[model samples]
Structure formats: structure tokens, C-alpha cells
Target: MTTHPDELAGRVLSTTQHPWRFALLVMLALELVLLVCLGAARLFLPNVPLIALDLPILLLNAIFAALLLTRLGWWRAAGFRALQRPRDLILLALPVALLIVPALVVGVDVPPFGKALALLVVTLLIAFQEEAIFRGVILHGLAPLGTLHAVLGSALLFGVIHANSLLVGRDPAFVAVQVIGSILGGVGSAALRLRFGSIWPLIALHTLNDFIQFSASQGLAVEQASPVLLIAKLGISSLMALYGFFLLRGTEMRMWPVSAQSAAAP
Candidate 1:
């Protein structure tokens, strides 16, 4: 459903005089909170890629989603709505192609059924949380600044948060590669989220992509970022970002939240 012009969260961000500044703080604050939560999660779960590692984040996402619905009786600009146009279905192509790269380059094996199931669940939640906060909250907060800033800002923050993996004791090289990949994926995902005004399809693509990569390692994906793996991701991710920007370029630029909210008014 579309965001109402009077919705508190959207109105607050879009109508605020310093939306750019507010958006920066909001994104940074989100990253900081999630990072600290990850670090704390490791203290208990310790194992990398734990399903529960993201439970807290999911809780946060649920709470945010609930708050918005309570305020407006429907989700607003949070990528909650389903894909609205049949033509938007084409937007999935680049993301899916980008995700398939590592599998083709390095190959993937199906993990044991239990492990695969677990990864599926974990990655689904992760995709949900990331899209909601990154594409949903951050995009809405920055939408007042115009579509370009919202897309770029969310993508950059998506990359930045991957740095938290280093804090969990990952190799710097590996973390660096992850950061870059996240940014590229983020750019494409953010652009598509705005275009399709939905998150379910992106969520599915993200879960499958990560599940394959994680399964490929049989566990060491956490411990290593092989040179070949890094190189393959960089190449494909660059193409993904390019396609995303091109899609964005084809669309007319506007203050997204403001325009959307205004249109929703009867």
C-alpha cells in the first residue's frame, strides 16, 4: 500500500527541513545499533552465520513494521508492498545474474538438508531485515533529498555495515571484499526496491545467492575469502551496479517520498 501524506514516519523525514542530515544520522544510527547487536550475538552464538544472530535485528524490523502499520493501517514506502507492475519483473534479471556469478565461477554444492534448511531460514530473515532497514527505513528517510541520494546513501551504508564482520574477527581482506559486494548489491537492490516498490523478490534473490555461497564453503566461507572468489564477485558485482544505475537513469528523478505521499492523497 502507498504511504499516506500524513504518515508520521514518512512525513517526519520528508517534511523536516534538514532531511539530508536526518537521513545520515538515521542510517548511521541503524548501522551502529546492528553492529553492536552482532558483536553481542557472537558472544553467545559464537558460530558464524547463526540463524539467531539476526533474530534481534528481525525483532527490530518487526517492531518498526508494526509501528508503521499502527500509525497508518498499512506499510508505507518500506518496500512492504508487492511488485506493482508486470514490467518491473524484468528488474530481477541483473540481480539474479549477479547472484549466479560465484556459483558459476567457483561452483556450489548442496549442503546437508539440515544445514541447507537452516541457511535458508537465516538468509531469508537477513534479506528481510536488510531490505526493510536499508531499502525501507533509510530510503524513506532520505527520499526527501531526492531519489539519487536515497539510493546512493542506502547502498553506501549497506557496504559500511559489512565492516562489522571484521569486528567479529574476520580477515580484513575478506571483509573488504564483502563490503564492496554489499555496496554493489545494495545499489541494485535499492534501485529496484524503489522501482518495483517491493521487497519480496529481492528477499528471495538475496537468500538464494547467500545460501549457495555459504553452502559452497561447507563452513569455511566464514574463514576464507579466496582470491578467485573475491575476483569473481568484484567483476559480476560491478555489472550489477551498472545495470541498476542504468535502470535508475531511465526513470525520471523526483523527491520520491514527497511525490508518492502527495499522490496518495485523495
Candidate 2:
């Protein structure tokens, strides 16, 4: 019997889905290239704006997501859902709350709020663009592999991509916590896509979470290195991971099909 592409993907994931394992490596390589290119471009031009790269990157990911959906014949599932349910809102809110806890723990610096508008703009741009790329295009491309594989693949990629940004002057422990939190966020985003088959809620949640964090960290000057802040970050990250775990286990039994099990066998 000839296996369908989707079925084949599902099968590969059934045994031990190494999709994220591989995807992260490729994403890291691309990120390195992008870093070099950006540095070189800035060096030569000296006037190129960093934001110039944001929109184009987002557009490319949106295009890639569309292409993947087309390949799987799920092309129509490309945009936002018309009516986001209460549960979706609730799920999105949990992470936002996670973001706020650190602020409460260490107290945010109020001075940045004066420039909150600019901070909000930057967070919106980066968060939506990055989420669309990792959770949309990259995740959708791995969809043929099954939801579990897609989530893992996309989450790992998201984590690694952010790791590059965290390599600078930040605390290593804090960076590690944020990466774990990002992975947790990735899981929630993937679950939302699997349940709703759209990216709007994820996009919203992504933007809001970042906006809250940016506003808190920069605008409010929440103590970044305080022990209290670190605990809150890790604590919330753990909670998100737990939430993602249960959400996945619950959703998988309902949505995955029998074909997923047999697709991998030759």
C-alpha cells in the first residue's frame, strides 16, 4: 500500500518524533546566516534600520505557512478564526498572568512607561513576526508529521532562535528561564492552532505576552536580576510546561487518527 505524505509524516512521529531535533539545527544555521548578513549590511550602509528586516521576515513566514498548508490541502486554515471562544481567551490569559508575576515580585521601573508607546510598538512587531514564523510556517510545515511532532519541532526551534538573542549581557540563569518559558509558550500556541486551526489567538497571545514583559522589564524597570524575579520566571515557566503537557495529552487522544500509527511502516 502506498502511504500518503501526511500519513508518512504521522508515522515517523509515532515512534519517536525527532522533527524538532532536526528543525532546530536548520533554524540555528539560518539564524547565524541572518546575523552575519545583518551585521554586514549595517556595516556597509551604516543607516539601515533594524526594523526594516522585521516586516519582510514576517511576510516570508506567512508565505511559507500558506505554501505548507497548500501542500497538505489544508490551505484554507491559514488565517484567524472568526470567533475566538472563551476558552481560547482563557488560555491566552494564563501566560499573560505569568508575565506579570515577575513585575509584582520585583516592582517594574515606572520611568519607561513614559515611552511605553514605542516599547509597545517594538514588542508587537517582534512578537507577532516571530510567532508567525515559528508557530505558523515552521509548525505548519511539520504538520504532516502529526500534532505532537509539530508542537515539539516548532517549540524547540522557537527556543533556540530566542537563545541567540539571549546570548548577550543578560544573566545565563535568566536566559535559561526565558528560553524554557518560550518553549512553554510555543506549546500553548501549537495547541491553539491544533484546536482552532488558525493562528490569530496565538498571534494575539504572543504579542500581549511580550508587550507585558517589555513594558514591565524596560518601561517599569522591574529588577531583572533579583532572586525574587528569577524565582517567579522559573515558577511560571514550570506551570506553563505543565499546562502544555496536560493540554497535549488531552487533545491528542481526540484529534489524532489511526492512520498516524501505520503511516511510518514500509
Candidate 3:
């Protein structure tokens, strides 16, 4: 029998297990890249624009993701498939909708056209790098643990990793909101990736979400706006998490084909 491409992908990529040692090394490599970027920024580009620093960081992540992909032998699994259902599109848009209220309330200053274009480029890179690592490497590595575990594990890691924002002296309240929001957003993005078998829409939605948030942060805004906005944001995020959970429960009995027997085999 001919296997569907998606099924084949799940069997070939999700079933393959890397050594625990390799997983630890990949996670360590990510941290090292982050430390190097922050160190370089502090030592040399203290006064540079945030994007100037972020661009190099994003580039390093892209390089690391590429290496991880090769090391894991997931070339076929990384294919960007088309969205196959209407629900897939809705899941992709849900995260963007969550940001709409905040964008309206905070409002953004119109930057010069060139600067705005440059900012968009930087945000796109940020989205690419983040999804490639969290949703790509981490998700693939953890798939044998079952979809629920993989989804929640990756999401929690995503949130915890953002704690690094505190090191830059961001307000505690702001960092807390960001970290929580990231965890919630990670659930939705990971579900959409699994459901649609593609990362393109996630990248687009993530870019839009980040660009709006980044613009609002740089523009004029009331100091009190964050807590209120965060409350609303978290509510929406909870709904998203619920939606992803329901979607997973309603789908095929197995999200990936890594059977318990295969998972335990040498």
C-alpha cells in the first residue's frame, strides 16, 4: 500500500529517536548562541538599535536550526505543506486576532517608510528563527512522548526561555506577561503545525503578532496599559489553548506514528 505523504513523514521523522545526549547538546547549543549574542551586544553595540542586535541573533539561530535539521535527518519532515482544511486557516488566524485589541488600544506611531520596512524584515527573521527551533527541533525531538506531552513540553520550554528578557532589565510585570503569553501562544502554534503539517502560516501569524507588539512597545503608551492588556491577552490565550487541546482530542487516535513498541526499540 502507498502511504500518504503526511503519514510517511510522521513515520519516518517522528519515529526516529535521537540520543538523550544529542538532545541535551542541542539545547545547550541554543543557550550558548543566546549568551554569545547578549555578550556581543553588551560589549560592542550598547547603543545600537534593538533590531541591529536582534538581526545577528536571528542569523545565528537560523544557522543552528539548519545544523540541527541536518543532524536529525529531518529534511522531508521540514517540508512546508499547504493548509488542507478551513479549520487549519482559522487556527492560524486565532493568534493574530488575539493581538488586535492590544494594537488598537496602544496604537503605533507611523515610522518613516524605510524604517518600517526594515522593522518588518527583522520581525520576520525573528519569527522564522523562533518557530524553527521551538516548533521544529524541539517538537520533533519530543514527538515520541505523545502529542500532548510534546505540545505542552515545547510550550513550557518556550515560556521559560523568554525569562531571559529579565536579564536586559525589562520590567518584571512586562516580562511575566510576555513569558505567559509565549507559553499560551506556543500551544496554538504547535497545534496548527501538527494539524496542517506546515510552518508557513505560523511564521506569518507570529511575525504579525511580534511586529504589532514591538511597534506598540516603541511607540507612546500609558504605563498602566500593560496589566490590563495582559489580562485580556491571557484570556484569549487560554481560549486558544483549549481550542488546541480539543482539536488534538478530536483528531486521529495517533497524531504521530511512533508506536510504543518502536519508541522502545533500539
Clashing pairs in 3: none
- Which candidate has the top score in lDDT? 1
Q: Tell me how far the alpha carbon of residue 147 in candidate 1 is from the true structure, in angstroms, after superposition.
A: 2.3
lDDT of 3 by residue, 103-165 (tens): 676665656788778779888887887887787767766766778877887787888877766
Which clashing pairs does model 1 show?
none
The C-alpha stretches of model 2 lying farther than 4 A from their native spots are 1-33, 45-79, 84-87, 109-114, 166-171, 219-224, 252-266
Query: What does each candidate score in C-alpha RMSD?
Result: 4.6, 7.1, 6.5
Tens digit of per-residue lDDT, candidate 2, span 1-266: 66576765554344234544545544764576567656765788567655355444544544554443343333223333454455656666666776666666667764454476666666666655666567655675566677787787788777766555442335566667677777876776677666655567766666666665655555322325556556665677677767676677756412223243333321
Candidate topping TM-score = 1
lDDT of 3: 0.67
User: What TM-score would each prediction reach against the true structure?
Assistant: 0.78, 0.66, 0.77
Can you list the residue pairs that collide in candidate 2? 20-153, 108-220, 109-220, 109-221
**Candidate 2 or 3, higher TM-score?**
3
C-alpha lDDT of all candidate models, in order: 0.67, 0.58, 0.67
What candidate 3 gets wrong by more than 4 Å, as runs, is 1-24, 40-52, 84-87, 105-110, 219-225, 252-266
Residue range 1-266, candidate 1, lDDT tens digits = 75545564454544346756765665566666667777677787677564345556656755654454344322444666657796878778767766676587667778888877877887777676677667766666666667777788878888987787765556678789889988987877777777776777777877777776667656533667678767776776787788778879865433334443533432
What local lDDT does model 2 show for residue 97? 73
